[model samples]
Target chain A: MIKVQQKDFNYSLEVAALSEGNHDVGGVCAFSGLVRDLVGDKHIDYMTLEHYPGMTEKCLAEIEAEAHHRWPLEKTLIIHRYGRLEPGDQIVLVAVSSVHREAAFDACRFLIDFLKTNAPFWKLECTGGDSKWVTAKDTDTQACDRWLNGDKKE
Target chain B: MKILYFSWVRDRIDLGNEEIVLPENVTTVEQLVNWLQSKGDGYASAFADLSMIRVAVNQEHVKLGHPIGENDEVAFFPPVTGG
Candidate 1:
């Protein structure tokens, strides 16, 4: 499942829905991203996340499909929220379920890493009287590239 | 063609989206960016650095050399920052 919405999501509810009645699923790995209260000692009042309406969902679905193609995932869920949000608010969720823990763990990592670079969401940090758009970090791009560079475990 | 801008690109260009009819010679994304830079000061400033820009053709990511059609939706934005 893929959701791109302005409303925050319940992580437990999403995980329950993903693994409900799936007896074969032995393990699940989930990762949630949250808005931080500070950036370099500056207090963040709030942050705004913006995304392309149609393209955001499409890109997320494609990323989910790629994850499934890579690992034997029994279930997957990706929820990303946009619009204005306060500090500590949930920004995104990626979860994966499989018959074994290894697949679930690796695929969950892969999903989040790919989403960092491929998704269309942009974040703006609002600090006090000033605001700045969050710059894309080279570390993120490098993390995403690791999957394509034969960094996977055999 | 429908041209879209997001993030800093939209802020610099001062518009979210616009519809335009592409010229005969503007058949690729790279050429379109070149032509758009001549439209206004905002366009020139927004596209001054191609390295910071990323493109999507019809909602899918593509390279600068990607071909474009009149009906296609092309978007320009900075590198994605979401997780």
Candidate 2:
């Protein structure tokens, strides 16, 4: 499943719901991304995230499909939020369940890595007296590319 | 045609979205950017760094060489910053 919305999500409850009553699933790996208070030396007061309405969901769905194709995952859930968010708030949640622990871990990592580099979302940071647009980091692209090149060798 | 701007493009351009009609010669994303840059000072500044700006044609992320047609929704923005 894939979802992009503006409301905050309950991560723990979401994990339980995704893993509940699945006997075939022997392992579940999950990740949650939170809003950091600082970016470099700048102190972020808040952040406003924006996304292309219909396109964002489409891109996320494609990512999920790719993960399933690569790993034998029994279930997956991706939840991303937009609009204004503050420090310590949950920004995204990714979970993968599989019969094996390695598959679950790898798929979970792959989902988050791809979402960071390829998702069509923009973030605007507000500092004390000014606000600025955050630039894309090169590290994110490298992280996502690792999966395409089969760096993990799984 | 709908033209959507995001992130710093919106800040520099001072608008998020607009309706526009491209000239017949503006057939590619590069050409569209060149034409838009000439519209006014704001557009010129917003599109000043063409290399840093990314384009999406019809909701799919595309490059400068991407072909654009009439009534197609095009989006311009800075590189994505999502995780």
For residue B4, give model 1's deviation from the true position in Å.
0.5
Candidate 2 pairs with clashing backbones: none
TM-score of each: 0.98, 0.95
Distance from true location, Cα of A52 in model 1, Å? 0.6
Listed per model in order, the count of residue pairs whose N, CA or C atoms clash below 3 Å is 0, 0
Task: Report, to 2 decimal places, the DockQ of model 2.
Answer: 0.79
Please state the Cα-based DockQ of model 1 relative to the true two-chain complex. Answer: 0.91
**Candidate with the greatest lDDT versus the true structure:** 1
Residue A77 local lDDT, model 1: 95
The alpha-carbon RMSD over the true interface for every model, in angstroms, is 0.6, 0.9
Q: What share of the reference contacts survives in each candidate?
A: 0.88, 0.76
| Alpha-carbon runs more than 4 Å astray in model 2 | none
DockQ category of candidate 2: medium
lDDT digits (tens) for residues B1-83 of candidate 2: 78999887888889999998789898999999999998888899999988789888888889899999888999998888876
